[model samples]
Target: MSPLPEVPAAAGVYPITVRWSDMDAYRHVNNVQYLRLFEEARVYAFKDWFGADRDLIDEGLLVVSQAIDYLVPMEFAYAPARVAIWCSGTGAASFDLGYAVAGPEGDDTVYARGRVTLVAYDLLEQRPRRLGEAEREVLGTVRGEPPALRGDRSAAGSRGHR
Candidate 1:
């Protein structure tokens, strides 16, 4: 496969306010909570594009893989950050989704970035399955480049596997 393009950040504004609970003893947003922000943006994007009925989660799909790169630690003062998401690599059985977190004003001074690969599954078959027509249609519609993989050059290398 060729190198993936630099996927432009999909503009998504999830009006989230920093809560006390999000802060850790160090007073920065917990590392794990940043993942939640990414999820929230993705869920909203899917619903906004495909409607709530055919929800991705309800389709019995789960995030099979994820990678996050923390750029700047979010403090309590950085409330109401916007989360952006985009897509790339709609492979036969799976696709790569990317995310970016930034403060308001839609800046690209990324506070965090992530990529998640998810595969469609047939519960009865008890294994991963190819992307369905409807699913492919939805994923293919995502335009622009995908966020870059952090750390090692390739996604697999970044995952620390040979």
Candidate 2:
């Protein structure tokens, strides 16, 4: 398969362990497991981006939407998979994060591309909440272009991948 587009310079790269159970009978990582890998990366990224003292999960961030495009099948390996993530878009109450699952930095074999839209929420108030200035500022540091996934009509004039 052709190598995926280069990951943005501002993106955060997190190495995610691929569990043996993550593989399917097809001998490749299951499509659904990609989401888990993304989640693992986010957890590590948030801590580093927002600082360990700040707990965004406890403060409330909810996944409103998610999408992924499988570009190549990946088999389980001893080395952890590298997931590069960045802020793609931002709003008052929500933001979009782009993800690329691939091999180590020098390796260009991207297995998948994905995006997740998350909303700032108030668990105590049981309602969506606006993002704080501090949160927005943090997001700005990691801002980059969205993943050019298949079926993503929002990506320029080019038709999405089949």
Residue 54 accuracy (lDDT) in model 2: 91
For candidate 1, the clash count comes to 2
RMSD to truth, every model: 5.3, 4.2
Candidate 1 regions exceeding 4 Å error are 1-11, 105-108, 154-162
* Cα lDDT, model 1, residue 120: 74
Which parts of model 2 are misplaced by more than 4 Å?
A: 1-5, 154-162
Q: Residue by residue across 12-112, what tens digits does model 1's lDDT show?
A: 44655666788899988899988788777777888976677888766656688888889888777554777767676687888777777776554435678
What is the per-residue lDDT of model 2 for residues 2-87, given as tens digits with 9 covering 90 to 100? 22367788888888889999999999999999999999999999998999999898899899999999999999888888999899
116 Cα displacement, candidate 1 (Å): 0.7
Q: For each candidate, give its TM-score against the true structure.
A: 0.79, 0.90
Best by TM-score: 2
Worst 10 residues of 1 by lDDT: 1-10
